[model samples]
Target chain A: MRKGDELPPLEIPITRTLIVAGAIASRDYQDVHHDPELARQKGSPDIFMNILTTNGLVGRYITDHFGPRTVLRKVAIRLGAPNYPGDTMVLTGTIEALEDTSATVRIVGTNGIGNHVTGTVTFSMRDAE
Target chain B: MGDDPDTPPPRPDFYDPDDSAARPKPHGANDSTAPGPRDPDAVAARPQSGDTGGPAVRPLAGDTDHQTPRPHAHHPPDDLLTRLKAYEGHPAAVAGVGKDPVNLPMIRHWCEALGDANPVYTGPGAVAPPTMLQAWTMGGLTGHTGRSSAYDELLALLDESGCTSVVATDCEQEYLQPLRPGDRITFDTVIESVSDRKTTKLGTGHFVTTRTDVRVGETLVGTHRFRILKYAPAQRKKPPARPQRPRPVVNRDNAGFWEGVEQHRLLLQRCTSCATLRFPWLPGCAHCGGPDWDTVEASGEGTVHSYVVMHHPPFPAFDPPYAVVLVELAEGVRMISNVVGTPYDKVRIGMPVRLVFRTYDGDLTLPVFRAAAEEAAV
Candidate 1:
């Protein structure tokens, strides 16, 4: 991948199952990520997506776009709007810089309310030759 | 799935809304507090939640029946805090032992759930993930939490004081040694601190922190510090129209498979070049770069390969205590879906299941499986 190359945007439909599945899978037992009633009691309108799930999804996006051959070296992200159930998160990546076999991608995942996650993913691909 | 052209049908699609409806029933699972249809046999058969493998973990704190406002509002903050403070630095659990020794099955399950592929977790001389420090001590749902009566009394006091809603605020762990299979685990916990009444965006409550020291045969393996916020649930928003179930994204490659579902057919892709059978409609064969493929119908016969029951964080759209299962078809392929006909706990590994189409929210339709073998009741 070269600087300025754009990876196709992946649209993820944020579902309740996916949210809960993602949180549990990460071993994060935070209820705000899964329980709606508790979430409301805590001031949230509903359960929201945890950061690890967003990180996992971003990694999946990069691997899917760069082909499975790429190795994800690092993921640095800052969460913004919370991804609530029934919303959709559209992830778009742009290669901000490239050096040797490694590429740095700028990723933004936005949901109905606003940008849920923004970060940089750096990955390295092996040369087929 | 009935066409029978010699190739097996497709596995249920994960993205399909209809597939998400299989609700797991709570029997011995500690992850959920929701009551659902259950069987006595299941309770006897299944290990308490927190067993090493599938569907084991769920949020722990704030799992109680406190939605209704307590007639007596707010216990005096000073009194509650004073009583809560009395437990500080007290031993909550001592000589607590793990249900199972550190083993590969649990490690494998943890890796698979998180999609972690680090080489250190598997193969020869593999060590369990260091992050699994706390899991080793959660003794199963058989009321073996290894807690001292004081700790139990402390939580009971908090519950009685009306802090119903819970959210885990933070966790800190320090790994001193790597845990491996065959190693026995032991731990001790102390009530580290309980904070005074505090207000945050989520609500107003006190913060409870517990520190645990985990050991493998006297070798200090790790230390886990956990904190949670127990707040009186705020009733700011009226429960809205139960949120509709989540929908799937249908693209060109998987469109035919969904269309087949619409027609009550489960279709599998038969690669034209290599003639390999593939579940979950994909564009090309991984076996060969074959560009084209056709469809085949499944026999609607499969066995449960594995499963996890969801009991916590009940969603508005989906009910708690449902089973999300992985089944291996007779054709040697696997897919994920919810099991409908039996209680979530009743579903077991190697049990037979047959495919059936289900619709949710009055409009969404997808394929689900019902236990094919006759239940003891049936």
Candidate 2:
């Protein structure tokens, strides 16, 4: 794929089950990720998405676009908005640079509040044709 | 970040790959993420170094370095690497305490998410899941709860050297005692070692390892080692052939089931004398001692009964942090399989699923279920 190509967007519904599952799956047992009560105690309005889960979803967004053979070499993201339950995160990507087989993608995951995650992912894919 | 990103380059655990142009491979997808003996051995395999392609991975590629000439950009590569290596055997944490004690609510939530029904995690005389040794001590969003200055310094050096990006590669844990409720957890971490620069298909970087000792007061409970691969992408090498899946055992009793899978049909055994249906193709019926049975094709409708998500120790040709579920079929039997057509986190208990025989790496075919929900997302 050439630089400047846009990946198809992915919309993920954020549910309580999704939040808890993502937290447990990534072994991030922090109370803010699974316990709404503890989350309030920790100053969050509700349970929210963990960084690891965001990383996983970003990886999924690319894999969905480039086919399964896509290899994620680096995922360096920073989170802004909290992904609380009932808010959906829409992920969209733009290929910023392509050199040989390596492609650098700028990814953003936006929710109701604002950008949930914004970062760059450098990945490669075997000739997907 | 503990997910293995460099294992045999996995298929989308939730999205099936188009295999029309796919070639059969050599590593078992099932074997890649399974917590088998391979994970511990892999914790020692370091990332390698490579300098090729263009200037994509050059230090300070990120525009965030707005400051004037940095000292790291002028130093020799060996001197910087030597400084990074010097931190080995230094304390990464000093008397670090878990933010929370081992409790039942967290345990219950963990089991519910994993769909693990083992009675040991709950009820009276309960103990936490052995896999959660490192979970209790996690720093959460307020990171570095117990981080020492030395560990931070090493990471800063790596960051300044143009290896600012990082992803967790893998982890190994060994439990010496059960972690029970009400037990306060404490741990000590040390910089294990910094690898010589290494290269994988992903890029060139060093594998940083840290060893942790978990304890309840003075008694040692377990040991854990986590690997973080600090990397920047380099040359674009032709991707290796897709790795093959571990072959399923096909013995005399189960051979017919595998044969049925090969033909893209799920087969179940029906007892001739007792009319009892059985899964897994046993030699005889449970009710009657009749060795005679007939094959019945399953209609492939099912619901998720129980499930687990794998997120560590990635293998060749498989992705971690993906769901593996036990599905209860409409025919009144349950079988273990993988899910496609939905993100793994969206898989829930009682979710409807339909059976599909999928071929991976263009060769190995297995009876897997696809999420039946019609959603607008990929």
Candidate 3:
């Protein structure tokens, strides 16, 4: 695999429930993350996912695709635009390099409005029975 | 300029509105004489105001039209987001050290077993050994037995597949002071870098390097650079043989000096009576044999009083071509310590030296001397 090769799309729909759930799980109490009114008061368009939540979700998507036998060696990701509720974020991973038993994958997540997060993930895989 | 009294000063045309203050004075004006409200034509030429307060509002004919454009809040860019995300995963694993806690009692036991008798460790000043402070704070050894630290938990999550083993190898520490008991130190550990290495068994495994910074409150106590190798099981190999070095025996009189060496401080015994400075610090003065002696802190800056290059040391830990020097400090004191940071051939008597802390076995802190440039005369 090399750079610019697009992988299969992993769709995760953004919702108020998921945003709140993630905020709770990560213990992020910043009101702009889960309260739309507070977010607007803070001059944002709407409530959005916290950076940590976005990171955890992106990792979850990659690990899910790679399966349990795959070991996630490393992941580097950056959060971009705010992911608003009701937006469907499409998570995509492209194989950047495959050497020996290890592969480097570039994962990107984008809503229809704009890109939300992009990262590079490395994994070592074993043959499945 | 005189006009008839009945002329009423030509009845300034207030109704004609050329001077009427109520007829929409130039929008930003506090008085009619000021420039009329900013030109409507110019306002129309600019971008339209959005509901989210995109454009600054111009005051209209009434006060109700006042509006202020709110600025957008700055959010982290995609690149920072990506780096932070990548940091969430565990670092590659190395060998030699595991994630088990180095408990406080265990550390105390290690210090006692090693025979360190500093009051800072045993008596009223019984502070935790400075280097051992990191293990007590962040090594998952404090408080609970089975619980892992924040970094350790992340490492466990990364290695859930169990394909690799994590090991810690290198550590660099700078001691500002000793850590007394009951001081809770916090740690921020990050996966510095990761790479792949050749596999001896089957396929390639991962090599992870982590930089764990340990701090007490806001003061940085030490930094540990841990290198781990994660790979499958390999064939059994023979253990490497150990090298030996001359071990200097320590008596009660010289014990404090060696302890100072282990603490990375240069300590010397100064006689209060004859003012004689002695090395290998003894409890009694060498000149007067007076028992009135006190510890003096050495600046660790000195001149090489004498030297030797050992090429025939048969110990596994003692490598050949290393210089051991007797340095005469500025205070008229002398000490025997290894000279580092200079070529073996460059070493000479009277060469200026500075002290440095060296870590052996990832635990013992040893103070050694290295060459330093002489200061220019003022």
CA lDDT, every prediction? 0.68, 0.68, 0.53
Question: How would you encode candidate 3's per-residue C-alpha lDDT over B228-319 as one tens digit per residue?
Answer: 44444333343333423445578888888778877777787888898787876666776999998878888877889999988753345765
lDDT of 3 at A92: 81
What is the C-alpha interface RMSD of model 3? 29.6
Model 2 alpha-carbon drift over 4 Å, by segment: A1-20, A24-129, B1-75, B234-378
Chain A TM-score values for every predicted structure, listed in order = 0.96, 0.95, 0.87
Evaluated on CA atoms against the true complex, candidate 2 attains a DockQ of 0.04
TM-score of 1: 0.43
DockQ of each: 0.05, 0.04, 0.01
Cα deviation of A7, candidate 3, in Å: 2.4
Second chain TM-score, each model: 0.45, 0.44, 0.34
- Cα lDDT for residue A39, model 1? 76
* Error at B322, model 1, angstroms: 19
Which ranges of candidate 3 are over 4 A from the true structure?
A1-5, A126-129, B1-186, B189-378
Which ranges of candidate 1 are over 4 A from the true structure?
A1-129, B1-75, B237-378
TM-scores of the models, in the order given: 0.43, 0.37, 0.29
Q: Model 3 Cα displacement at B112 (Å)?
A: 48
Residue B323 lDDT in model 2?
Answer: 91
